[model samples]
Target: MLKELDPLLHSQLRLGVMSLLMGAESAEFTFLKEKTNATAGNLSVQLDKLSEAGYITIEKTFRGKKPLTRCRITRKGIKAFEEYVQALKGYIK
Candidate 1:
């Protein structure tokens, strides 16, 4: 069933993350956490899933000795999101 939709872009949090990332060049972990209203642990898990699926990239860096996590959606992710929207529209009528 998910295949009919976009397999890579169906989960709620994942979709939310991708949607936000798609609109920006990149976004910070805290920004996505706030926007998705997800706990850090949950967000981290979801991010790992996306990264493993090759749908998004996660970069960890340091800012003044503090660790920072940033995210960006891959081109494959963009295509998946587009397809997911199209699939949803198919049922809208």
Candidate 2:
């Protein structure tokens, strides 16, 4: 039987976010938006869901005069992503 996929990370945008976060220390909101080709409002909402799940951390601060938002995957997120990959493998084979 195929393993169940994580509903949260299963989202294309969220999955893209996690996939990108795995490669770097942290990512700025604009960078994720650009990479995922997501709208600002949509990305913000998805980020909130991940944050609520404790899978990622969101830091909001000011960079000079502008608001700066950065996201970093947590240990929980790494484990979740890894498991998600493993589960996907089960289906592929």
C-alpha RMSD by candidate, in order: 2.0, 0.5
Worst 10 residues of 1 by lDDT: 1-10
lDDT tens readout by residue for model 1, 28-83: 99999999999999999999999998889999999999999999988987877888
lDDT of 1: 0.88
- What residue runs in model 1 are displaced by over 4 Å at the alpha carbon? 1-3
Report the C-alpha displacement of residue 7, candidate 1, in angstroms. 4.0
Instruction: Evaluate model 2: give its lDDT.
Output: 0.97
Q: List the residue pairs that clash in candidate 2.
A: none
Which candidate wins on lDDT? 2
Error of 1 at 19 (Å): 0.7
Let me know the TM-score candidate 2 reaches against the reference structure: 0.98
Clash counts per candidate, in order, are 0, 0
Clashing pairs in 1: none
lDDT of 1 at 56: 90
